[model samples]
Target: MLAELINPYYLQVASFILINIILGVSIYITLSTGQLSLANAGFMGIGAYTSALLTLNFDLPIIGGILAGTLLAGVFGILIGIPTLRLQGVYLAIVTLGFGEVIRVIFVNWESMTKGAVGLSGIPHMGRELLNTLKEFGFDPKILGLQNNQFVFLAIFLILLGVTISIITFFRRQNRSRVGRAFAAIKLDEKAAESMGINITYYKVLAFAQGALVAGFAGALFAHVLAYISPADFAYHRAVEILIFAVFGGSEVIWGPVFGALFLTVMPEVLRFISEYRYMIYGLIIIIMMAVRPQGLIDVNILNWLKLKTSKRRQKHGTSSQKSM
Candidate 1:
């Protein structure tokens, strides 16, 4: 694993985790709002296909392609959510699952561009080739960027990482805001939240849309990071994996998903001996983790924080009682 530390493959792995972080965070938005969403994978597929088609067919700039991919996915997400978010529980999952299937079929049969199930190739590498090409064009790789692939990859990785961190920090703050409380109440009881004047449809669709949008962002990032893509990559299993990470990380905690993404992305590489059975083992481990720490790794790690909060509250209560005495 240490040998891979400086490899471009490591950048590939880091990119995977980064994309998953976005995907996981998107799921967090929905689950935190008390809705189980499944269309995230579909959005990811949309982003991948969108960016690939744009850059490959039209020769669009990499950045432009990524943006277009994200926007297109967000649009599709909003459209799909409008009708499906109204359904509750398993119904929503079924709806999103169906959407994912539809996307897979579209990418498979659309051979004119997507190469029909063969997946897209010759994709522009937004991370590696882009950096190298920039350097070759006489740009000062140092004043402009790094000549080393590792350093360049790290620079781009930092940019993606920063965006993710900023978004998480934003949401963490929002968790204490009025909208966050409303979403929480809605999650606790949709009917009761509506009774209390919350707009159920608005929040529900917003949750799904937000999740889809971020998944799309991750999808675009994934496309550029790998410089190649295939329909198999975004299959139902991919959706399930994202869900597993969200749950395994404690969907409610912002940092939990990040750890989940990182661990899962690197776990198979670490367990190289069981490469063939890695996925199966991943499933087994997820099952065990869920059974053992259902709230997620973050919850387990922050036991001290919870204890501190409880102790402070108890002390405050005791002081109030003493004053009464």
Candidate 2:
């Protein structure tokens, strides 16, 4: 384990965790509004394939490709949301799942561009220009003593970390707004929320669109990090994994899904020694956790515990200050 920590592969896994966290958070966005969207993987595939093709064919900047992909995904997300968001529960999930399969089939059949399951290769490095720009500013990235890929992963991880923090902060603030209340009300009972004049469909679509934006951005990052992508990489199984992260992480908490992603991404690697048994073990652990804490690993009880601890510390500090005065 210590050796692995020192190796570059560890950094690669860390980057993977960051990417998964972003995907999990994307699902959480829609989950917050009581919508179950399984088409996140489709949006991700759209972003990856679109960005890769743009950069590969048009010689566009990698960042531009990523931005364009995200925009296109958001547009498509709204379109899909409009028609599908009307369905609720398992029916909605099935429709989104079908959409994901449709995307996979398209990628598999489009041999000329998508390479027909051969996947795209020789993807340009996203940080090539950025590294050159840094050199122009008299900064030597090589001085960091890391391989180019390692350095790129670390840089991407930091950038994504900032993005994650910003998203969490935004949602935390949103939770206090009227829109947040509407989401909560709708989640509790759509009929009651509609009685109060809240536009349920609008909020649902908005949440779904927001989720697509994040998932698309994450997909772009995944493509650049890997420099290779395949249709199967973003298939139904991958979508299910992202959903598991959201459910297991306590979607009600902004950071819960992030931690869930981190843990799940790392757990398999940690259990590498067990090989085949590891999966069974992992399944057992998840089953036990679900039975013990169905609310999730980081549910409201943990949040309330932390809040109480904070209040106690604040009270103690205030008492000390009063005594000193």
Candidate 3:
């Protein structure tokens, strides 16, 4: 696993997995609050555009660009959440879906700023400078036979790992906190949650804002890594893609989407042999899986099993250490 972390090819795939995990978690935030929001991709577009423009025009540092993007998108999330979160079920999904389309159209028609469908290019890669810094500090790349890109990949991987861990820890804490309990109540039953003194509106809006923050940060990182983006990139189709990441991954559990995104992101590549029928095969597989197990691949049972396995392993290791002593 350590050896593969520095492999450039695998690193690229890993980057996709990380980004998708972030996106999945973003939606999971809303779903946790019993809100069905499909506007994540729209918020992501806002972040990508904001960060890309800041870096391109104002000469802002990549981190500054990302921060600005995240803040701006959170504001947008609050704005959108105010009206849309009031709706429920398919209606809410439709309105949010429309919002995504509206954002995409604005990006397309606002040619003066977005360059329309021509797409932004020449965006800087976020970790390139870190690699240069490592070299300047007397680190010998030749010692490991690693190229500059590999170093860049390692930097990105570590940064993303930190981000993922921090976010996951924060979310897990939320799951145990008062807010998380309120979210659970609302999700299980809104009227009942309201009766119990939970402010449904406030919590729903907070969920939207939280989700947007994550999506925006992911988008900023995405723009920097890919070095290009366009209006079409944030279309309704993109919104649906992100939704698939959440739903197919088992939105019930925090880690489910990560698993789903990782598998789905790599599955197509693995099925590339039958290029023409790859998507057909993929769709068929999803249909079969949904039919057999609609709750998704990850659920309470699997999570518990994993936890139990880890605990046993730890106990065994502790016993060995004590005996050796």
Candidate 4:
């Protein structure tokens, strides 16, 4: 069993884990800020299609292609977020779902750029091309300008994942900042906060844009890692799966999505021949989990809830003691 996992195919699974981890965390962004975004699939599609087309047509490097994709996706996010994030609960969910569908239709119709339903073909391979990625590292061109693709791909993934983790951690800390307070205020009580002069729209939009950026980046990474991406890869179902894992993990925290993504991505592969029954078992597990722990299977929310309850109980006891005295 261990030997099979050590094989080359395992590399693909590892990459899959990385991709889902990004997706999960990206969804975590809006979720933490109290927004439920279903448009992650659209953002992912935007990044995948953008990066793939850029590399294939312009012969650009991975970094440049990814940057271009991220920029475009962010712009689209700003446009959608400006108007949509204000809606909360099922209303916001429906709006985001519509947004995802719109992107899907565009991908299907934009044959010149996306190749429509037939899907883009003959896209450049990530192998030797991936090796050329060292140019971004300021590595000595004289020695290892062209490392093996396998080695380079893994290195780049690690570097990118590290950078991503750092960014998320930084953002999590900012939750204590004024801006974070604004988001928390809005999330907790929009009407009260708005009455007090907080511009709920701006904070919601920021959360939306941040989530889109991460999803786009995830799409770009998956594209370059696999060297092939299609509309099928970013379908609405995929977006739902990302959101499900985010909630099932713990959107209240940052790394929950990462853990959720890793767990869910590997679960199916382990089922092997029972793959046909995989999602069934997976669904049952999620249902059972939610029944027991609706907050999340691995939620840290319990501590906060217990603290609140204990403090209230102590206050009540103190009041009774004072009255008796």
Which candidate gets the maximum TM-score versus the true structure?
3
For candidate 3, lDDT tens digit of each residue in 1-325? 4444477877787887888888889998998887888999999999999999999999898899999999999999999999988799989999998988898899999999999999999887877866666779998666676677777887788788889878888998898899999999999999999999999999999999999999888888889888999988888887888888877878888888788888888888789999999999999978887887788888889889997787789788885333321
Give lDDT per model, in order: 0.80, 0.84, 0.87, 0.77
> What local lDDT does model 2 show for residue 200?
90
Query: Could you tell me the lDDT of residue 280 within candidate 3?
Result: 94
Candidate 1: residue pairs that collide: 141-145
Error of 4 at 267 (Å): 1.1
TM-score-better candidate, 1 vs 3: 3
Over the full model, what C-alpha lDDT does candidate 4 score relative to the true structure? 0.77
Q: Lowest lDDT 10-mer window, candidate 3? A: 316-325
Off by over 4 Å in 2: 1-7, 127-129, 136-138, 142-150, 310-325
Candidate 1 residues lying further than 4 Å off, grouped into runs, are 1-6, 140-147, 273-281, 300-325
Estimate, for each residue in 167-190, the C-alpha lDDT of model 2 and write its tens digit. Answer: 777777887888888888888899
Candidate 4 residues 225-313, lDDT tens each? 77767778778898899988887777766657777888888888877678689889988878887788777655567546766687789
Q: Model 2: which residue pairs collide?
A: none
Q: Tens digits of per-residue lDDT for model 1 on 33-145?
A: 87787778889989888988898889898788888988888888789988887788999888888899899888888888688877777788766665667678876545533
Better of 1 and 4 by lDDT: 1
